[model samples]
Target chain A: GAGVSQSPSNKVTEKGKDVELRCDPISGHTALYWYRQSLGQGLEFLIYFQGNSAPDKSGLPSDRFSAERTGGSVSTLTIQRTQQEDSAVYLCASSPGLGPITQYFGPGTRLTVL
Target chain B: GESVGLHLPTLSVQEGDNSIINCAYSNSASDYFIWYKQESGKGPQFIIDIRSNMDKRQGQRVTVLLNKTVKHLSLQIAATQPGDSAVYFCAENLHSGGGADGLTFGKGTHLIIQP
Candidate 1:
């Protein structure tokens, strides 16, 4: 079975620039989540989507961060006016919404704000 | 500060030895706990999980223990191997009203194996 996938394995951008990261969840997965990991830090919850009903944007660090999941399959996280402190690895994970709480993750996109 | 945080970021142990990784989580409302292993340049893989109701649960060679009194969770790997060398993360699902609530993770502990 195909696992979750993310694009732009690595990204380098200047401060104040905007970047969009993509995530492709496994087939039939109804749950998708986005997280951020900074150096020597833990995974910070960003947003989550379940069957496209008003994604949970509670974890977004600031107003500049936003995400959208379409057709309950793919998700994109957009960081507007990125800051140097926003440099970190962005992780995406997905799981089935029925029984267990196990989440399959994707190789994150490392964003470097210079 | 009551958040998930690791006491040690790096731990080195010899092969065949038992490994213990510790984590402290705040928010006593966290009833669900999970352990994830992340290798270099890869996403996290689920290792094991335990609910707050149970104090201990075992899976294969890994065991997860939860102490609600102290708000502590630990993962013990029996007969550790080189393949087990990676970063271990402890995450908690804060029981909220929203569907598909997010998980709060602790700073990961990087496990190193000595041959």
Candidate 2:
């Protein structure tokens, strides 16, 4: 079966610009999550989207970071007015349902804010 | 064991030797723990997982141990190989009524395999 996939492998943008990263979870996956990883650091929780309820934005660092999972399939993470600190690897993961929390990840998009 | 803001801790081990990586989680409420292996230029790959109920679980060559008493978790790989060189991360999740809560990850440890 095809695993989770992400777009643009890499992205380079200027400061203050906005960038969008896409994620395609495996077929039938009902839960999606977005995370950020800094160099030599751990994965930081950003947002989570379940079947249909309101997304969990608690881990979002700021209002600029927003994500939307359209039709419960693909998810897009948008960073508005990006900053140097936003330069990191944006990773996406998905799970079959969610109760037990077993997730599979995508290759991720390395975003560079210059 | 665990790191704060500094760079990820490094564990150097010789090939064919057993390597054990440790993690100290902050949340005692977490009921599930997962270990992931991330190589350079790639996303994290799931290694093994353990639930709070069981103190230990084993995979092909990997074992995950969870100690709820001390809020600690450890991953032990039997007979490490060169391909095992990568960053290992321990993630914790508390089933907060919401089944799909985001995971809280530890700082991760970089494993260096030497021949």
Model 1 ranges off by over 4 Å: A98-100
For residue B24, what is the lDDT in candidate 2? Answer: 82
Going through the candidates in order, what is chain B's TM-score? 0.95, 0.90
Task: Give the number of the best model, judged by DockQ.
Answer: 2
Alpha-carbon lDDT, every model:
0.88, 0.87
Q: Which ten residues in a row have the lowest lDDT in candidate 2 chain A?
A: A51-60
Candidate 2 per-residue C-alpha lDDT over B1-115 given as tens digits, one digit per residue, 9 for 90 to 100: 3321213399999999999999888677777889999999999999999988999999999999888797778999999999999999988877676443877788789999999
lDDT string for model 1 (A67-104, tens) is: 98899898999999999989999999987862247778
lDDT of 2 by residue, A45-97 (tens): 78788865544677888999888888989999999999999999999999987
**TM-score, per-candidate, Cα-based:** 0.93, 0.94
Give the runs in model 2 whose Cα sits over 4 Å from its true position: B1-8, B98-100
How far residue B108's Cα lies from its native spot in candidate 2, in Å, is 0.5
Q: What's the distance in Å from true for residue B87, model 2?
A: 0.2
